[model samples]
Target: MTVTRPPDVSVVVAVHDTMPYLTACLRSLVDQTIGAGRFEVIAVDDGSTDGGGAELDRFAAEHPGLFTVVHQPHSGGPAVPSNRGLDLATGRYVFFLGADDLLAPHALERLVDAADHYGSDVVLGKMVGINGRYVRQDVYARTDPDLDLYGSALPYAMSNTKLFRRRLLDRYRLRFPVDMPVGSDQPFTIEACVRAERISVLADAVYYYAVRRHDRGNITYRSSPAQRLDTARRLIEFTAGLLPAGARRDAVLARHFDWELSKLVGKDFARFDPETRSAVCAAVKSLSAAYLTGRILDRLSPAQRYRLALAARGRIDLLIQPALHSGSAPLVLEKERVLVHLPGFDEMEREHFVFNGAFDSRMASGIRVLEAAWSSDRLVLWIRAPVLGDGAAEPAPLGISGVPAEVTTELAVDGSGTTLCARIPMRALLGGRRHDIRLAVTAAGELYEFPLPALGRRLRQRRWHRGRPYRISVIPGRDEQMVVRVSRVPWRRALLWRKQ
Candidate 1:
């Protein structure tokens, strides 16, 4: 049965706390080289702060018929609001313009024309990440055989940077799931890719995707292996449910299973205590059978398939597990250990020390270092450590670390999950400040030096260093919308003034 297409084009702009990007995004939509009346922009306010709700009304007032504003509290992801936009859209084609991304002048015209020209349900065009003059690839280029995406399946990459037919969505009953912490674009695009009867890829880069490096919200399971595995398990179930009925699908499912298993057995637990490893391994054993039999595994690679094949055959091997082997101590030059907790997960990661090449180059690949600070209410972290033989370096010697004004030092456990507390009398004795304490940690057998910037200021003498901890920053609250990663950061020392 052939599905009929709609008459006009509908653009869904889901904004939450993204007031800053809204005006630009909306302007881009209405400024389409094709003119305003040709398409309708349905802007949904997903419970945004920073006056996003009111801004929607302002735009609607100015644009009138060309705009439709749907207001709802911030749902988990843009999926729900996008789905809401889908329900109200009357266009033959629909595209989600991420608030942070912009549309090329002809973005609408190109995709719209492509949909009609190829008689395709999906119209994919090239896109470049355009943050300032910095241009990055769109990830949808149809250049490599390895990146081939044909028919209803998407290329291995999923950036909602394409123009899709509204009819195709109706035909497949496709909608985004608001529940997934992240990678929601994965299932939504995959479903469309798998079911798309006709697809087109244009060579032109009409969409500009802005890559916000500071935004960490979309990366829920990035640092936590356990969380990623759990999310993968749920998504695996969803993908499996959409699979074709047969053993071919089982092979595809197996490949994905290997990945989740790797996260489970391979990452977090590769070096866990014996009891912890056994508990997790037991859990995987229980889920492996059903997971392998699921659908959507038809397109997996041989190596990926082999990994799963091994696990499926009760051959959970050591190679698939993630392990960390910290070798011998370095030349005992310098050491600085501070307890820090990044906002999201409940783990206190310690930045043991910053290494300087002052030691041995061989130490670079062996240790990992994290620079942590509280930027606004968000705890931001920048981590870089060397992979063995990865040319790791000791941290550039601390020019200095600056912290906030010296307040009365209090010692207590931050009940938060980062399991950290300065030993009681440890923090108390250091009264009003003024001390030349040089801390050092030998990471990779090198001696490096670090001076506390806040400590320097506490003395009221003077700040000698050129750099301070102010170097670290969070995204300043993401302009109040557009899931740019949110967290509850309390007001505390701007520096402890340990401006390092």
Candidate 2:
């Protein structure tokens, strides 16, 4: 394709041997809701052996004015290809798209509109996952005209698949790290977010990040933990150099601890080889001890906080216990304390541990459920509420929807607050079908709702017992008590089951 004039946006695609999915990805860009004259595609074929170069050539020939293909020797990573595409980009704004991913029809139009309207140096479009769970739409729940990378939730949207003003990149001379094989885009994205004068988020615009269900070719999915951790260390050092030591820096690093670093202390930790385990443990311990402060650690979930604490202490062996449980362990609440009962662990092990109780500021005034457990016949909830003055309070009647059920409530006063234990019949609530039972307490002619913690979904681990064939999940709901989803096992084998 002959380049005549600069376009509004340049779509930079770095392709390797992604022939199977490249056609759909290129097609999505060509069929953009934005007019053809407004955008151009600059695709770099990084030494494709599987005829992907030919595919790009065909596309270029078909749309000479809109598509341009650059052929380069394999650099073993996207960094070189992306850098080449950047050099050849002749657009006011640059948007990077993966060769295996597609964009929503109006992605470029919305991003350009938002960038122009807000005069933003960087504009982020929402990313939706296809055939995988990589998408975090919550990060882009609202549109921000001027987002602070450190202060706002924009740091969570730190993928290179965003629109950047061409002048900003040229001024900063920003390019991806060519040496790093994995997580190469992170440093580039981080630096861009830090240097940009104004960044806007267009939550309505979507970029479909495709994950191949079979034979995924992304380097990240195939890289070893040691390899990935090396890049992680580099990224951490790079990020530290950008920001001063304070809440902002801690917040940015906190994401790494919560998501990436936490994997070392997850269920798969025990499965690693001795060398891999030792290396991972050492790296995680060092990273956690250096950056994971109480201020930042307090913001994570109970499970995460516990794991990080163990990591910081360098108790890799002890970390394995909680990791093995996989969040199925029932939480026990006593007075002001929250305890996790690990399977096969001694009572001393269970009693010695205490999790962070300050989930949110609302827990100070209203009632909060610290832990919940389910049995064949009953559902037990451990709750903490404000203490009554005289130590004498009327029992509040608990309500269970979907079927007739018996509710029993017991209250005890302690040094911290009033502890309420409620037991409800599970059979009546479930009724052999999936049900979201809402529990409420009626006192003084008013209904008081109990807010439960939002434990994210997990289909990978079988939390429910074998032969039971019924799984119950607790999701945070708009109303009281939380929403409970019960589902029968669709097959004899689990969803994520593999042959041992």
Candidate 3:
């Protein structure tokens, strides 16, 4: 099995003890729609004791020139094997795939096409999580044929599951940091992005990132908090060193703070020992002090802003306060405003304490529900929130966050009032998971957000779709307001719809 000519794409798969999923993963690669001759698989078996090495050999032998196997002693991580694969790659472009993951049928073809068309040094294929959770593909919300890593939201797609031109790698001398036990890919991906002149995005291409059920062997699930924090600090330092101070640098730092460091102050923060908690808080505070600025903080969500501020100030007690009062405060919607009454935080006395704005403007500007109905047959829910005042400006063009404006609803004015309504098909809104839907309105050229008030507890309904029961209840928010909670039927019947 020898290569006479360069291939279109070189897929580098680093495998350890993933025997159960290796077969499917290998099969997916060999049967790629991009054609066997166009691509090659360089499977690195990292001293797998689970017969994954034998599986790799068998695939390589069967595929002949299409598959190559590199057997090496276990390095305790994917970085070493990945670098080895890079050394052996001969294709014009390179792709790194996890041995447990699978690629969509046309993933390679789509990526290659985008790269060729834009002469891109890197092309990011969309990633889909299987039996695992993933961040929303907001980075791919809109397509940009020619994407700038620093300017665009491309930094958020920092995973190594992308197509890279071999030329770019050689030019920048990019390699994964073998010293890192976790998140080694972060530095490599960040460097590649920063150095590459042209990076294209192929939103339609899919890379299935599979999560093993009941298996804690995955490196991500096995890393200790200290190890992760160390990796995060290294990554932040590496990324910060690449870019100068400005909006671009701030954007990247914002993602790290909001997504990675912010986890230290999450609900699970209480589970950590005092020492570990203090170490995490210290690391977060130090990083934030160096990189986080008002511009970056201003763009984050209110919850994120609150937690980050507390962490930066070393207010561990205040940081954990929200978790202690979790679901304790009932949301109150009165006087055309939504309020969450934290035990210590005074809502009435403190100005700008509550999340209120044009939605509760004194000039008779508020939404009122005129009618509500759900059709199980069509899987659509209809709600009419009409403008109350006589001179109201067409209900301020209502929209729902987490939902596309075009598909969420429509606006119409009838004799009753200025109606803001939508025939929201559940299929469109329910993305196979529970989502918090916030109402957004553009009033006087400014956007205002309000929680979609729950119709009423008694008005709640249970509907079935495709043999599964979905409980649509009007739950009170932690703040004073109503939110529609659409959830699957609880496994424990007694705990179904219990008040939070």
Top TM-score hit = 2
**Residue pair clashes in candidate 2:** none
Model 3: runs farther than 4 Å from truth? 1-3, 205-216, 322-325, 330-500
lDDT of 3 by residue, 1-500 (tens): 99477899999999999978889899889878898889999999999999999999898888899989999999988999999999999999999998888888788888888899888988887776777645458677666778877677776778898899999999989999999979988889888888888887766545455555457566777788778778778877887898898988887877787767777667767777888888888887888878878888776765565565556667677656753336333223334444333333431232212434333452123344445666662323344443322122223345667544333443344422234555555664444444455656544445656555545443456666666667665456655455556678865662454543
lDDT at 20, model 2:
80
Clashes (candidate 2): 0
Q: Specify the poorest-scoring 10-residue window by lDDT in model 1.
A: 455-464
The sequence of per-residue lDDT tens digits that candidate 1 reaches over residues 1-500 is 99754445888877776656667777787788866667888888888887878887888899888889988878867778888988998987888777656787887887787778677777666666533324334445452222234332343345565678888889888888777655566678767866777667776565555534344322332335444555566656766787765663454345446555544544344455555455455555555656654343344433333333433444434423332112222222223321111111122112212222224333333332223344333322232222111111222222112222221111112221111111112112123232222223333444443321221111111121223212221222222210112122222443444453
Q: TM-scores of the models, in the given order? A: 0.52, 0.68, 0.67
**lDDT (CA) per prediction:** 0.50, 0.70, 0.70
lDDT of 1: 0.50
Indicate the worst ten consecutive residues by lDDT in candidate 2: 387-396
